[model samples]
Target chain A: MRLKATNIEHFYGHEKILHGIDLEIEPSKITAIIGESGSGKTTLLAILSSLLKPTNGDVYYDDISENSIKDINAFRRKNIGFVFQFHYLIEYLTLKENIALGAFDEHNINTLMENLGIGHLANRYSNEVSGGERQRAAIARALVNKPSFVFADEPTGNLDTKNAVGVFELFKSFNDTTFVVATHDKKIIDYADVIIEMEDGVVKCISKKRV
Target chain B: MITPLKALRKNWFKTLLIFISMTVSISAIFLISAISSGVVGMYSTMLKTDGDIIVTQKGIADTFFSDINRSLEPKIINLAGVKELNSMIFGASPVDNLPIVAIYGVSANRLDNYKLISGIYPKNDEVLVGEKIYKMLNSPKKIKISKQEFKVSGVFKSKIGFEDGGVVMGLNDASKIFHKNASMMLISLEDIEAKDMVEKINNLSDDIEAKTTDNFIDNYNQFKIIKTSSDIISALAFLMGILGIISMMSMVVNDRKVEFGVMRSVGLSSTAIISRLIAEAIIISLFAYIAAIALSYIVLEVIQNIQKFQGYINGEITPQLAILVFVISIIMAIFGSLLPAIWASRIDPMSLILGGSK
Candidate 1:
């Protein structure tokens, strides 16, 4: 699935957070949005993922505009997943239960848990595990729905270098799902197939890595 | 995924607070209902008699204050369907250490109603004391009413609540003490003639009214006042209980805003989240209702043992009342959680994530 955003602009009250922006997210690739603080990278990612509606433009999934979709929540449920910087796993639920929150189908859950290397910790609460383990569970939750695209905002912002690399490696292994990650970390450039840098609410450069 | 259950388990203290508030509210309603039912039961038992019709002064709030001419008894007994007639006086006075003791003045023929448990029937100025009053007065040999001394002839028992805690004497002595001709008259009519007999008796005088036993009980002003008061108090208690549940649910939703945001971002719709919240509230209310039933029973038992409420209140919980309370509990649950659930559904996932990031 291809995600396209054209002439996108956003405002928080009277302050404009994002200017007119246009981008196309190619299918099945790691597209990283890298920028310093307050550059509106997170805002743009939110717009493309259907978490927030842009003030001036619309996002499209394979030529179907968001405005045309009758139920946006249903569309996101069937096609999109999310990972936040804080790994917002419900504290009361077990890791397995947290992952099941996003699953529309249950047959693949066990297999996915085992592949994530946290199968033995499935019954442990999110607070009972380490930060890296919790984030891994969050990633498992994102992919459990078998969505076409996974939007992550600073998913590894709280992890160490080793854990951050491991997270990117996990993202790289899922070749069928497009990943759009917004972060300021330079390490993501090594694994990203496409990198878009933003400064002060506008795109500074778009660079594609040669195969 | 049992998220609501898991959340309740994790926050056991909050769950307990909500449970207790709901239980108290339900119990208040149940207790009021039980007491009202008990009072009605006592009245029903007291009014039960072999007589088919009762005659009393019209427009009186209490039968104790009713005053009918004693000469009407002879005319009523001579009526076509009249089999027998008994005149009686009812009054209340403080005796010994007791306040407001019921006093019944009965004719000699009405002695059949009292089951003599200890001694013989009363005569002239003598009196028969009820079992409860006997115990309360420590088997007194004689008592004083209106500065007149009367010997205690015996101790008797009756199913009637007022009779069980009262003093019974000869009708003439009661008339002298109360300074009245008669309070009321009881008429025993031939089979299937009560309706015609009541009308004939009512026509005998303009100041007196005659009614069959059932009609008399139905129109009793005291019973109506008790029932209406109980209903009003129960309604207020139910409202307060619902408000308590709403406040508790609002707190729960406020504390879980971020969790709801996470759920929404993961593709759970707003309706699904609201359903979960309502489900939780219902579960809590159901458990509270069960607890309230048990609590009401315990309270009733304790009250039944008190000397003042002995025969007057049986403290029975009827099936109809229980079912009514159960239905009210479910309604309370839904209404209490609706506002909070709607508030939770309107939360913006993006704002939560962004706010948390900062």
Candidate 2:
């Protein structure tokens, strides 16, 4: 599925967040939005995923604008999955049930966990797992529904270098799902198929991987 | 959801506190109701006179201070609704300085208030004694009160509580000994409209208050004070429960704001989140209900077993009253938690993300 944002402008009480940003998310490819803290990468990612509405302009999923859809929540649930930087898991639920919250079908939780390499930690609560394991669990949740677009904001912000690399490699394996990640991590930026660099709410550069 | 259940389990102490409080409140209500019923039963038996109206000194509020002029007897007997009237000259006297002994003065041949078991009704110098008091007087045929020698005319037995502990004598003789005129008037009405008759009697004289026996407890100053004060205590207990629940739920919602945000981000709508919180509140209330019912039952059993008060009073909860208590408990649970639950639901899903509400 194609996610396109054209001239997306967002403001928080007159404080500009994203300024007239235009971007096309390639189908089934890993797209990374990289910027420093407060540079609007998370804001841009949120706009593309329909989690937040833009103050001006629009976002389209395969050519259907966000405002044009009658049921915005249904659209998001059916096609988009979100992963926050902090893992944001239900603390009382086992990692398995947390992943099942976004499962496309009932039987996909185990497969999703195994695909993310957190199968052994399935029965453990979110509080009982390590930071890296929690991120893997979050990744499993985002893809468990087989959503066309998975929006991840700073997915490895809480993980060590080793765990961060492991999470990216796991994202790389799901080649059929489009991943849109916002991060300031250079190691994560190096592995993306397309990179969007932003500074102070404006797009600084858009680079395509040569390989 | 299991998340809310786990949260309830985690705060078991709160649930127990509420349960104990509810149990105490409900048990008190049950106890008060039982005692009140028992007291009414006793009054019904003692006041079983054919008289429908009791006339007392204005604002005396107690029979001890009731004093009416003996001269009014002829006038009162002529009033409308006056089927037949009897007057009592009653006071407490001590035998050789013993504990208080109750004494009532009655006219000749009016045996409606007593059943003679031994001797006949007393003349001016003799007295009729209750069965229990006769035993206390060592079953003697004679006793002396305030140095006056009186023969025990008969031993009468009545199940009425206070009457069973007292003595009776001739009206003029009692008046002479007690140095009082008439104590009060007991008038039997020919009609059932007791209120209207009482009003007529009260209007005829300004020194007396006339009322039907049905309004006895309501007009009695001590009883009215007790009822009003008990009602206040009960109200306070319920208010404490409501406030306790509101504060506890508010804390819970405030602590879990971020968790609710995460739920919204995943797939839960605002309505779903509100439903979850309501479910949690209900679970807590269910635990409290079971605990309170058990505790209240135990309290009632303890009260009913007191050897002295046994068979005289019973403590229990009727089905309708029990239902009312349960309904109030559930409403307390729901009303206390609703505002907090709504607040939790209105939380912005974005604010629940990383660095949100920081």
Candidate 3:
């Protein structure tokens, strides 16, 4: 479950969004991507999540390059999980159904919800919860599938300082779980086992702590 | 496979819209079919007025206007396939200020051929009138014909359009009012299986034509005009329905652009998204089918009961037609949402995550 993006380059129409970038995400280790607004941090995350394809290079899940993979969707569904800033929960389903969405039969959504402090909200509708609670619920849903890799884009971007710290702590508990978090929050820097900084769509700094 | 029922519950509004459009389109098709069937019903009613073949003057524009030579009966009766032959006269005569009243002169022996709904067949100069014409006159049960003051003898009911507006009396009594040999002949074959009865009768005499009741009406220019017109109208309705589906589906797909994008980012393939949308569309169309059938049945029933149209105006709704509409709506919905779903799936996930479209 190691994710490697090799010399990745991407553009939107004529303007380049992500320039030649290379990075390696360690298996079962928490990695943090930090950058300013237009530094392509989210673009790199999109590539790792297999939601976008880099124009010049390819993503590697362990030894297999994305191009050699016959079914990228099946790969993503079985191994990758995504947690966006907005917590895109389907409005029509109750919290329990949404959390249980992509999980295998062995996955326990009720246990995940309880661990995330969202057990009582299982029967509630998406709109009935507060923003922080909803974010927690989203995290619970992502983990319920027990994906090998989890991608988080600005997970605490919309939260207050207290809730922001709480969310970062939630990610820290997954130290033995592979997680690539994209954020501009200064408060989450201490929780990272590895920190990668992006500037103008290229990697600027890579700092790691021996695990 | 995602359950369509689940999707419907999640996206109730979109589902309802698809259902409504399908219902309207299906009902339009059914309405058109009912009107066309009404024509056929009227034709069948006309056939029930006689047993097999009807005869008229060869050169006459209409059977009611023909002058068949009464002496021809002997020649026709002795023909190989002939069993029994009877004659009748029909014409449009003025009734006071009323524009025209249809008058029919029949031999007493021929009265038994028709099913009278009410009253008895008129004898001598007395006459029987159609229920429709009789009701239109607002006469109090009894009415006078030709000032001879005959009782309202009988009211006959027939599916044929001709019987809808006419009065019947003895041929001798009618001859006194208007000169006529015989207008038409109602003939039944001695052998019901005779295939060449019409052909044989046609060869028996000049200035005379014989045909089965169904073929005779089908040959009418009036029936042809109506048939052609219904086909054209049905075609137009079908086209409009397709266009309607396309337009509405475009709006629906456009409205759900962000939703589809979200689905794609959640590891759903473009094909999966397309399939889900199509499934939703089909479920919606099914709802509409049920609605349209109910609405159409109520509508046709009201028309039949209120108007009392004797023909097949009260049409039958078949399950095949419902299934046809359901499948057609699904196809139309898939085509409509196809391009939109593809566009949504092709969206760069980075752009969406960056809150660019917001």
Candidate 4:
């Protein structure tokens, strides 16, 4: 396991969202987390992405300490990437600038855009583009920082079947890094190397398949 | 640093409003400065164009009412550092219908300083009248002076306190007509130092005091303090204007909360965001200030040159006023932009990325 969580507990105000959760994430592999609504799938993803703090226990990033909120935030910034259902592109900037924004280096933006098949949409404003194009742009933006792990929460939740398959296949063909995605769609299940089913914030079953 | 040009392009209307506020603040300051300069300019012209020194009776607060003792005239002339001096008899009094006209008695040499617009300077026993005084004379062509009628010298003007409407005559003629002692003396310096001249005059005469022409003219009109007070009041008004602009800028930043979050996520530091906003404000304000100064100067100059104001208002716009307005505008821009920029820098990129409201 490259990233590990041990006895992690999380809460929002007085209500408990995660209880002594323990999980291991492998390197250079695609991991899928499946759960029903309100099953803590998104919450766990947020905590794993360092966007939320655990109430107790600890999370480690490849042996680096992420036990504190500051450490977790720094780790998220330098080593982790995130994508969501909304795309959330900056409306004022063009697609290319938005994608390059994550890298903090304008020089590498064009190359990343070309590689992601978004070179033609580089100058298009976020609001002017279609949902599929914006999602692709978001993926490009996430990958631009060259993070070791990419976390997605319902990335294709709002997309049609064709775009969803295309997005899953894009992640499936990524050879350079690992991915942890949460979803309910059965269409994407075939591409996962490992699938964990979550119910009521607990992992009820796990399955593995050969690709 | 986030380039301000990009921010201004993104938020054009907000930038424009900031620029407008800056313009108003700076213009208000410049207006006050111009009025002050005009007052000072009027006093300077009076001193330079009228007399070098003014002598009035000691213990008398009003120059127009001071009366000299004739027995001290020769002693004054023999004093060290003594210069050319002429006694003047001028005052105001009630007549049958209204206040009597202002009057002055001058020697031949002092007559050259008066610019007669329509008539000549007073002859040996005749009197010349101020334009305003001439109007009050009520006669069509000539007016009576003591016992003889003198044709009104062309209606004239002087940088001195000619606004009070006065008449002038030879000192001897005025003393004979008014039937009183001389009121004051106007002095012209040749090579005598002002301090030594005043000291000698003070020693020679018992009830006489000498003052620099600048001070004399300043005391003549009552508007000097008003000019300075207006400047202070306008400066305070500009400060309030800057504060108002700052609040408006805060609203602009508040409206762009999500955008700031995106910027932070994209590797923009807080410093960069603040710098960008300040730069945008400065650019907009500088442009507006320069344009406003140019417009005001042209308008003021044209107004000063109009027929009715040719002698009364000397256009006093100077480069110093423009420079002052420009600098104030820049300062106001930075002050207005600072807080919002700081807030923009504080936005968390993570909250924005994770489906949280900025």
Candidate 5:
């Protein structure tokens, strides 16, 4: 799905977080928003995924206005998926149940866990696993529905280099879905198809990878 | 389903306390109402003889304290709707070291077969001794009442505790021994209602009047206050159950806010998540209700089997009332968790996911 944003502006209370931001995302491509802490990368990703509404601009899905959709929750469940930075796996649920939350299909769970190399931790609760394992489980959850667009806010920020690379390689195998990642990690940015650098709530530069 | 259960397991002790309090509140209401109902029923039956209307002195509160003489009795028998009248003279005589022996002296008509539990009714200076009083005697066959020797012709039982330990004999023997007259008269009516006859009897004289079961109960001021107080206690016990369960569930919901937020992020709809929490609540309520029933039954049986309390009252909750009380408990849990569950569903994944608020 192609997403085009025109003049997106956001404010948290009286403080502006995103100022007149504009961007375009192509279908079936990995777009990375790179910035340091307090740089509005996560805020932009949240707005684009329809998890948050910007204060002053509109987001369109394939040029169809998002505001016209009656049930935004249904829309997100059907199209967009999210992976948070903290590996916020529900402490009460095992890795498997967390991933398959109303995904409408369970046949792919075993294969999906095996693909993420978290098959051993499928039945283990979040507390029983290491930090890297929890991060991988969060990614598995974002992809369980095979969503057309997957948004991640520092998906591998909590992982070591080897585990971070492993998580990045897992994203490379998704041929049908687009990956929109917000992170400051150099290793994750190396695999980006397009990198939008942000500084002080504004886009600073746009860099594309050479194939 | 398993998600909520696992979360609840983390706070099992608190949850168990909620269940315990729920059971306690329900059982308390049941026990209190049962005992009050039983006591009211016992007194009501003992005071309510086989008559549509009872005639007594106007100021008397209890039927046992009424002492309208035979002068008022003939006037009552000649009333328009009067079919038959039975006069009962009752007194408490301290006999055989038992300070309170309720004695009933019946007029010629002792035809109320329900009062006789075993053998023939008293005849020829004989008496029917109460089952409890007979048990207290060395020889159950005979007993001395009013300083006169009388054979214990039969044993009788009355659900009322006072009458269950009393004696019954002829009216002539009572007046001859105690030199006192009738205390109350049990009057039966034909076509007119007892209250109508009561109105006529009151118009006839100021010394005595007639009262149906309802009028007597209205004037039974002591028990009226007790009934009112017991009803409020019963209602408060029910309220305690509702509030306790709701608060417990609400607190549980508060503690699991982040977990619910995480679940919402995983694509579970608000309805799905709320239903899961409600399902967990129903399971808890069901277990607690079952435990309440079983424990109440055992405790009630134990109370009833005790020697002094054997015939008092059983605290068995009616199936309908039990189901209703348990349903209210579940509804309390539902209301308790509902708002919090909805709040959890609406939790911004931004705050919880990014640790932004922290």
Candidate 6:
């Protein structure tokens, strides 16, 4: 599915965070949104993923605008998944249970955990596992539902360079699903098919890499 | 997929606080209900007589204070369906150091209701002491009432609550001591249907009123007051319990806001989250109710064993009371969780995740 945002604008009280942003996320590709602090990377990622309703303009999945959908939650539940900077796994639940939160078929959870290379840690709590392993579990949870689009906001922000590269490799391996990662890490440019760089609250440049 | 048990287990301290609050509140309700029921039960047993109808002073609030002229007994006995009439005087007097001791003065025929435990029936200056009173008085051979000394002829026990903690003597002696003619008269009927006889007896004298045993018990004002007061107190305690649950659930929801946001971000609907919270509240209430029942039962047993309450208070946790507690618990769960559930359903996931990010 194609995700498109048209002239998106956002405000936090009196201050404008995003200004007239236009972008199209191609299907089955990794689109990296890179910017410095206070550049509205997280806000734009939130707006594009339907997590936040834009102050002005709209986001569309294929030909259907977000405004046209009667139940935005139902829409998100059926098609969207999110991975935050902090893994955001429930402290009481095990990794497998956390992953199962997004799973339509619980039976597929074990195989997905195994594919994420954290199957052995499936029964470990989020606090019990290492940071890299926890982030892997978060990724597994996001993809467990087989959503068409996975929006990750600085998913590797807390990980070391080796673990961050490993996370990008995991996104690369999942070729059938589209991933939109908003981050400060320049390392993601190596793995992304499309890189959209931002300055202040506006897009500075867009670069496409040859496969 | 959202099970409440995991959250409860993880937050055991909060769960324990809520559990203790609910248990204490529910136990208060159950204990008050049991004691009230016991009071009514004791009165019912004491009021039981072999006669079909009872005659007492008209418009009296308590039968203990009823004063009917002894001359009316002849008229009551002559009424149709009247096979026998027994006059009795009831009063309360301090004996020795005891604060209040129930005194029943009846004719020898009324002695049939008591089972002799260690002594014969009393006459004139002699009195039969109740088993409990005898023990409380240290099995004394004599007890003084109203500046008059009487020999303790024997000890007796009875199913009637008043008879087990009271003194029984001849009606003439009681009249002399209490300075009253007679408190009430019990009339036995040849036929069980005594409704007409009651009316006839009532019309015979202006000071006396007649009532079937069932009618007399149903209209007893003391029992009604006791029951109403108990119910009001129990309701207040139950309300406190509900408030405790609401406060606890609201705190839990506030503490888990970020968790709820994560859940929403992962595709769980707001309704699903609220349902999970309600389920948790209900589960906590159920456990607390069970604990309260056990606690109330223990407290009741301790009370029943106390010397002052022995034979007079037989507190039991009836099935109806248990079921009532269960129903109240469910109500507490639902009402308690309503506001918190609404608050939980309205949580915006985007802001929480973004807030955590920045």
Each candidate structure's TM-score, on Cα atoms with residue i matched to residue i, is 0.92, 0.69, 0.82, 0.73, 0.79, 0.91
DockQ, candidate no. 1: 0.71
Best by TM-score, which number? 1
lDDT of 2 by residue, B84-108 (tens): 7788876877854345777888765
Model 1: CA > 4 A from native: B48-52, B78-86, B158-160, B186-197, B308-314
TM for candidate 3 is: 0.82
Candidate 5 lDDT by residue in tens digits, B93-175: 76565555778888868535336667787876888876766666643677777577888777878667556667788887776
Higher-ranked by DockQ: 1 or 2: 1
State which candidate, 1 or 3, has the greater DockQ.
Answer: 1
Backbone clash pairs for candidate 6 read B119-B154
**Native A-B contacts reproduced, model 4:** 0.16
Candidate 5 regions with alpha-carbon error over 4 angstroms: B1-4, B44-228, B302-314, B356-358
Per-residue error (Å), model 4, residue B166: 10
Q: After best superposition, candidate 1 residue B123: deviation in angstroms?
A: 2.4
DockQ of all candidate complexes: 0.71, 0.37, 0.41, 0.27, 0.50, 0.64
The digit string of per-residue lDDT tens for model 6 on B1-358 reads 2558999998888889889989998899999999888878776666655577888899999978999899877666776678888889989898887878889898878877778989788878999998888988999999999999999999998665567888999999999988888998888889657888887887888888889877888888888898999999999998998899889888988888888887778778778888888888888888999999999989988876677753566676899989998898888888888889888877777756566542
In candidate 2, which residue ranges exceed 4 Å CA deviation?
A1-7, A11-14, A50-76, A101-107, A144-146, A172-176, A209-211, B11-231, B294-316
lDDT of 5 at A174: 91
Residues B27-50, candidate 1: write the lDDT tens digits. Answer: 999999888877887766666575
Answer with 1 or 2, whichever has the higher lDDT.
1
lDDT of 2 by residue, A107-178 (tens): 978877887778999899988989999988888777777888888988998899999999889878888889
Ordered by DockQ, highest first, the candidates read 1, 6, 5, 3, 2, 4
Q: Ten consecutive residues with minimal summed lDDT in candidate 1 chain B?
A: B305-314
The CAPRI classification for model 5 reads as medium
- Off-target runs (Cα >4 Å) in candidate 3 are A104-107, B1-18, B52-74, B84-110, B123-126, B140-152, B157-187, B190-194, B205-228, B305-351, B356-358
DockQ of candidate 6 is 0.64
Docking quality level of the chain pair in candidate 6: medium
Task: Write one digit per residue (lDDT tens) for candidate 3, span A1-211.
Answer: 7788888999978999888988899888778999999999988998888878788898999868988888776677678888888887777667887766555652488788888888899889889998898889888767776788889999998899888888878887876569999998988888888999999999999999765
RMSD each, Å: 2.6, 6.4, 4.4, 6.1, 5.0, 2.7
